[model samples]
Target: MPVAIRSGVAEPVWFVLTAIVFLVLLRRGQRRATPAAVLVTGAIVVAGSLLLPFVLPPVADDPGTGGPGIDGAVNPLINLGDDLRQGGDVPALTYTTSSTQGVYLRLATLDKFDGRQWEPADIDPARTHDVAKFPAPTGLTSAVKRRTLKASVQVDDISGRWLPVPYPASRITGVDDDWKWVAGGLTVRSRSTSASGQHYTASFLDLKPDLAQLRAATPSPVGMPLDVSVPTGMPAIIAQTALRVTANATTEYDKAVALQDYFQSDGGFTYSETAPVDQHYDGSGADIIAQFLQKKAGYCVHFSSAMAIMARTLGIPARVVVGFQPGTPASVNDKRVFQVSSHDLHAWPELYFAGIGWLRFEPTPGRGVLPTYSDPQAVDDAINQGGGTASPGATASAGPSSSASDPGGASAAPSASAGAATATDRADATPWIVLIVLLVAIALLFTPAAIRAAQRARRMRAVARGRDPAGNAWAELRDTARDNGWAAPDTQTPREFAERLTVTLASSAARIDGLRRGVETTAYARAPGPIRVEDLRSVVKAIGASTSGRDRVRAVLLPPSLVARVRGDEE
Candidate 1:
């Protein structure tokens, strides 16, 4: 480790990672022409972006009504959803006093699957559900003032073989196997093994000749292999863009430097959770590149893609690097918190310099050197700032519920309001404004009779499972059908529930039957437990698959008005 950073240039791991990332992107590009493939890709990205995080305790960065106030004091990042799991009821959710708790807001931990997807980190039958450990002491490294910046890390997972931490990890911690640090700024295992986020501490030693001095020196003749070619359609754009951005730079390093600057300039780049994905269809990698340029938006993947494509266009080989960014050093007693957010998700390009293995270029905005905690003052902001409501489109929860006429009964039913944006106040007099909208809403509103009459049709479903015939379940089932444009009979029996399922939603019949049967079985068998999770899974899936299921998904995903026609049938 000491010998590696003698020259403040990048380590060789930079090129290897770039090559691997490029290969993955190129393969994806090869099949981009197919719509089906592109859609699948988009779907995967979306699902991964959404579903996976929730199954486990929600990751801090996982989207909800989160922001820099209210729950900010609790630092949800400290515990795996302790605040949300406790439903904001836990005292931990409140922080009257400023407590810099030593909790690790896990910057990134993929227990399931490899580098991508919701695949379980491993299918180890004997694997513990939860482990009683932290990054092993050896795994943890420290950047002691002098002797050495000991960075320790542990790889506790077994699904994927990829390492943790982002590029430019100047020094490593906790890597104590036969493995040694590589020039690419990472440690490598001879074979793939899911490793833990080893705990190690290290400091960016003040090597005499820093970046400038090293860049001035010639790069060593380390063999750089083109493990992966640029995805198709990428080459042309890469060349053109590179020429436009770096034509002035006489040397490769100079060109790389200018491109880095442009990204930070008027590129409009950002670390957004709202980036688009081609989950289902396969678009040419070139098309993906084109979309990026036109849209000029996305997560790290996009930024890295654009940079590499542009660099290659100018005849300079470049690759993207994916790793955790440098974390701010913090010492905690109870738990070492490493809070990572959607903001922490980043991507950057590594341009190959003749003598400098690969220099890092942060194409993604809000990246590079950042704080360990997401704006420590955010807690104080929430504290000093009294209660306010949050309205839609407000950054996370700007405040509280502000007014009535919350569009579509959005706030009609009081929710917990933990993350409500600064909503329009109830008395924020919008007399004429409310009057006009109310008139419009009234013109489109249904009478109370209509609401009751509709509810009466899906008469109380009394499953034998000791469920109340006319309870929340009944209402829920009825609403589910109505949402799908299916109006169940008032006397819906288990058989009836199953029979009413339209062929379009035939797949969902099993679910209705399962729930009905389970309730019956519980009541008849006098079972002590409720529907097991496994059984509930299919029931939920069925309800989700039915016509009503489609409606529910649409209503939640898209605005209610967009699906007004479909909903009208339910009424």
Candidate 2:
């Protein structure tokens, strides 16, 4: 086929755009001054533009690998690798008997991209098969002492459904691809989640792909693909880099052998997470490839990406595979079985040669165990390849958790804590939370002055008509007092108010100061500015109470706004 080569730079652009939607939908948007009718309409638009994707698959960056497995179109964010790396919970490292299995934390699988978005299962299979295969590094090593390692996986907080397994999984069974092994079906794929959680066993077989045997087995092309559009300048540099690695090799197998040796050598293994911010941040994919090859020290993604580009320079078709390694035993089960956690996630490369679909090659510093099949049942199934029936683990991750029980399991249902809140609800409420805060702020800004002006106008009217202006003001204050759970004394002086407050708390010197200020502002300087409001608020109702007192304690006790804290504090 036409070599469908790609670079890492193209993938992140799509992911960044996908993650931004979560942040944008959080705000109510520019509807502050608008009326309810217009605001509601705008909210709907924003909801569709942002929140809708939470329900639908992200069509932009993904190429259809399968029918959007239950994990749906946004598998990258749900998988432990991308999900945990970005932020949030540090993924649990131990996979116990109760952890999830049969979860495929898919990396990047593109079936079709129709201009603007990914169509995850709609790409016709005919277009996927490449006719012209490129050359890749694979050699024969005649050691036949096969070693086997067993690894299992578990899932806890992760959602969208898919099985999790490292790449090159040779035989998977006892769980549910619902049991089809597609030769290259080594990558994990699952469509369901379990309720009680899951566990599964995977066997990794170590093989020495003998160079002499492989070379004699068939004449093939290197798996690295190419495009005519490589930035012309970087192509030459990429070629030089490739030549440096394989110059001593005379045979294609030897060339492949040299490339592998270069990667495994000590000078080859440096974990690289840092990139030249401004330069690598640019869209020059070729430049990124050349830089990575020159540095010789990057993570698996960088290594695979650089390898692909350099291979293309030598006319090979290659691609990067982001999956997991056959995991280490997570925990011993009740049956004393060992389980694996999510941390085993890994990435590597797949080089395609003629006739041989795609063989796995890990250029990363350490070696990862690839799965092997020893079961007679497994061999029979392999001889008779079924549908997508080849799956992993018997226990599926039921649906995502809808409840997190306290240790006692006796806590009340969450309804926004009376005072502070649980971290989960706080994070979940981000969009609405920001909007509520903004609205409250706007109301406070204008509402305080508006109510005062109306009061002054009423008082002036009362005086002109011969009503008691002072009485009117006191009446307004009394009405507010009743609503606020305060009882203004029918006839009391400033001294009387202070004495009554002192009786409640004889040692409250600080609060007494605030009360004194309120009394002066009310009984002496009062008026047009609502200065005396503070004093009346203190005497008639509870104001400026110590934080340790009733007010601060109440918010956490009542929770939702309707549940009053200090009698009238709910409003």
Candidate 3:
């Protein structure tokens, strides 16, 4: 069976068989069974289950061990091929924005490269702030053309401590107070809360700096030394390749563009998810990148890490960003939404320039949108035709030679207008949009099941905390019954509902009877003893297992309990 179908079916089958065996044994020993015998059997089962971890070998491909997970947590410098190989388009998030430019929902930035892999810089207590508002972006100057854009994000399936937001966010709302803003990269994260059920809106700046501005801007290493530091044992080929690629370029920006072009267009690199694994160079360490430079075939992690390390060798401050690219555009409830899935997981490089801060460059071919400002061919044409510079007021909408006052600008100067034409062509040549559209429907179809699973986990956590365990467990039972096509009407007493469930599910009557007594005791008694959450979960699992396979599928997909909530019914 496929992983998707197996994951949904395996647990229920196991639990149902276990329950049947237990019931049959109990019935066979009814005349001779004692409380101590039952307790001893349960203890043996629990002890054996606890020892399985030590008996079994570790799974090398587990998430958080060496690769990015379906959740937003990533170890970018290690390996990112595992999740990419999962081979499913699971939805991660959805957002709505009016901005025409593509969006990159950033999760974390890797600034320090240890001998092994790249990691974030150590957290500074003074630099961390509450997530309600963030400090201004580092090194951003007023000379750069930018506009404020707002996006509303709703997390669907991804869960982790890292909060995904647009880069350089100015203000954020709707997240919990525990989420903290790390000022170094303007990234949000939490120590106490998971970013699973969050719905937040972010106000961020959309920076648009023309090629001339980037060329004139000098590289500044004032407060960032780690970004440019290379380990002593790094392969010499990294620096050699960086210098060779940008040898023809004169300025810092041109050098950056040259390196980007080398990887994206000129280097003859191929994007393959399995190549690095097959070739035994899957990580983003110095040796792995040197191998990638030779192999010329790998995924975004290899490409991005290679570019960032290469830029650092050339005295440029650079870092790698792990995040999702702008997703497929779709309409939901008559509103436009961009749906991002696990398949859109990507990594890219950010090169720091003076007066413009850290500008993103896409060096991974066939992966993401290449920013118009980072177009090497366009910058070369503008520099050759014009005086190799634009006025300080030049905007992204105008060409590099827009400042030239020629009455015959449209006809006489074809080379001067080439930069603008190339930008236009890049905008129209988005192939990812069409490919992702075919996947949007599948993601949206499974969204209800994901939401129901989250709700169940939340309720289970509450029960484990001993916060009204009886009431929460009872509510979950009712919802489960309703989802499996059984009804417990509002008018029925707890005892009557339990009796009906006992007959409908053909489960052990004692389990349903015990749950009914617990609910009655919590609701009616002045003081009630605690109800064990494990017992409650066992009863619920047994009931769920009793349903047919088709019923289980429908229950997961359409979940009538959620519909009943919207319709103002208590089922």
Best candidate per TM-score, number? 3
In candidate 1 the C-alpha lDDT for residue 450 amounts to 42
Cα error, candidate 1, residue 492 (Å): 59
TM-score against truth, every candidate? 0.36, 0.40, 0.55
Question: Could you give candidate 1's per-residue lDDT for residues 74-187 as a string of tens digits?
Answer: 111122222222333221110010112111111221111111111111112222211211121111123211121222343332122233332223444444443333322232
- Candidate 2 per-residue lDDT over residues 1-571, each given as its tens digit: 0001211112322433433454346434543322222333333443333334334543422322233122222223222223213433333223322222222222333221111111122111222222121111123122422233344545433333334442333344355423222112233333333311334554433332323333443323444232212235554666786788888866544454456556656245555434422234211145444565666655444454455445445544444444333333333444433322334344444444443334444455543421112111332342233211121221112211101101110010100000011111222344564355345434433443345446545754663454543444444444333333344455765456556556755665445455455435555664522333333334333422423454433322222222222123422
Q: Write the per-residue lDDT of candidate 3 for residues 1-571, one digit (tens) a residue.
A: 2212211112323533464477457847465443333433433443333333334543321122122336443332232355566767767788887565346777777777754466666333233487667777877789876667788998766655567788778889998677777756777777656676679998887666656677888777566544468889889899999999999999988888899889877999888888877776776778778888999998778788888888888888887777676777778999878877776667777878888888777677767665555654454453344322222222222211111211101000000101111222222332332234224434445566778888888888888897887778788888888888888677888888888878865556777777778788988898754666776787778777888788898788767787566445554
> Number of backbone collisions per candidate, in order?
118, 62, 0
Worst 10 residues of 2 by lDDT: 409-418
Which lDDT value does model 2 have at 301?
49
Residue 445 alpha-carbon offset, candidate 1, angstroms: 52
Better of 1 and 2 by TM-score: 2
Candidate 2 wrongly placed segments (more than 4 Å): 1-153, 156-158, 166-171, 176-198, 201-208, 217-235, 264-269, 275-285, 329-342, 353-357, 366-571
Which model scores highest in lDDT? 3
Evaluate all candidate structures by whole-model CA lDDT and list the values in order. 0.35, 0.35, 0.64
Model 3: lDDT of residue 528 = 59
Q: Report residue 51 deviation for candidate 2 (angstroms).
A: 13
